[model samples]
Target: MPESNTTLAIRVQGLEQKVPTLDGELQILQGVDLDVKSGESIAVTGPSGAGKSTLLSLLAGLDMASSGEIWLAGEPLHQMDEEQRANLRGRKVGFIFQSFMLVESLTALENVMLPMELAGAEDARTQAENMLQRVGLSHRLDHFPNQLSGGEQQRVAIARAFVTRPDILFADEPTGNLDQANSARVEDLLFQLNQEHHTTLVLVTHDLKLAERCVTRVQMVSGRLEAL
Candidate 1:
């Protein structure tokens, strides 16, 4: 755990993002600031095009900010080159997406093992298998993503995200594509991992049930941060 005063795991201050389009320069996020503590769970809620996902992408280093500061685990995201950003993300960040971004060509086990392989962990296979089993996908290890149902595919994706034991997780609308039953199950699994691993969680979700369950709720309006 980080020391009390330094327990912050993610920080953003005075952030701004813009893009040039036919209409004009579009501001996606404006002077947004936030701090995420170790082991904290925060849900960011906003309407579509309010920059929820865009902000997350920036936080995850999948995209760069137009200006201002973003620090993850004390490393300045804006100062890093692409190689450094990729290294940092691989070492500390995990992601879960609404689309269940599983590789179609890989089997469940293979998908889960990819991260460990990249990290060059000697016991990658064992660790990946354990993660898959914990997610209730042990029986489907050899099944390809295309052969699995939506729920099962998501389970595999979740397992993949945990295989490296990331320090923080960024989930974007994790339950969006699922039915109520599947969504509930995935929700349980997510919180279970949080409790078990004490992973820092930052999520952008529209589901009221999931949103309210987070430790904090951040509202965004017109690309500006608002009261919870």
Candidate 2:
């Protein structure tokens, strides 16, 4: 499919996130501004506690910002409550976590079918099968998460994330737990799927090599974001 008419997939202005501490509030992200065009790939890289993950979370509407405006596919995320944010996320966004957050009890097919089924897609099972096959996990469809290797579990996670054909994909440290070979495989699949589906990608990672693959790289330092 081609990219959407919207030129910008994400737009953030003066974004800030703060958490309460014993003394006062600690700021994680401060005055962050960003714009990601449709079908563009972005990598957010920074050191520990630099708020790279926090920024990604806010952009994906997984967390509320303390202050500022965030527009996701032209939808005003900062003005929405949790329920509205959840609805928006479910309809237009896909997320892949570093932990390979697959349901332990569900088989690979069932896991991948989850989002499609939730969206009331009648062909969820067939699409799930095809997606699993795309990730080279066709034979593992019946396998449980515990029965598969770490790499296989990650593949399942990737399949689940991309099955919905979301408008934007958010990935946080997607290859953090994988070995070199598996990391390469996952990276390839991530880019391949993004290009094929014309999904805007926002990835958070510490690996410079991985970050370099993105069309744009933004670095976070002490709660501020800057282009590198």
Candidate 3:
């Protein structure tokens, strides 16, 4: 087992991912090593098919790497089973997806409350309301995802991700679906919350401007990472 680092939010060493394809083995990531300190922001930038999303999934415990050691928020992700990883994620991780993956059947407030509710939090509703208000979504609390516009839905997603105040926040193309104005607004909101919460942010984005906003930046190329 790899030794845990209290000052590190994420540590990846000798990471590799391989999938057996019909043609042959597909290597999506190779020998990836990274260390993100607590409360730091990093952007993973890469072109399509460069294993950017795969790395994010592995680091976030959504999937296991073929070979690697991953320590997330002081927990050994590589050594954990699915259930253990899921529990760890529940306690320390939050995610915002490019598509604004909200529950259509639930209202904005309900969506934001889901994580805390799942964790058996007694004040989930109140915390969710407060987070929504912080994201400027107090007026849209009762609105469903389908009823909201793209920007509004993303705001709801942001509120949901931050409602639990996870130690690490993983955002994949957070503003990919928004217009210029909305993108700027969301960018500001993301950084603001990151600062206030002192959360470690790992973002995967194609937008160079967004990447530049991060304190640290790295680019993925042909399954390898390079400093930018």
TM-score for all models, in order of appearance = 0.97, 0.97, 0.98
Model 2, span 63-150: residue lDDT tens: 9999999989889999999999999999999999999999888999999999999999999999999999999999999999999988
Instruction: Provide the global lDDT of candidate 3 against the true structure.
Output: 0.95
lDDT (Cα, tens digit) per residue for candidate 3, span 144-171: 9989999999999999888888999999
Give candidate 2's error at residue 117 in angstroms: 0.8
Q: Give me the candidate number with maximum TM-score.
A: 3
Q: Could you give me the TM-score of model 3 versus the true structure?
A: 0.98
Query: Cα RMSD (Å) between model 1 and the true structure?
Result: 1.7
Highest-scoring model, lDDT: 3
Off by over 4 Å in 1: 1-5
In order, candidate lDDTs are 0.90, 0.94, 0.95
Query: In terms of TM-score, which candidate is stronger, 1 or 3?
Result: 3
* Model 3: lDDT of residue 149: 90
Residue 73 displacement in candidate 1 (angstroms)? 1.2
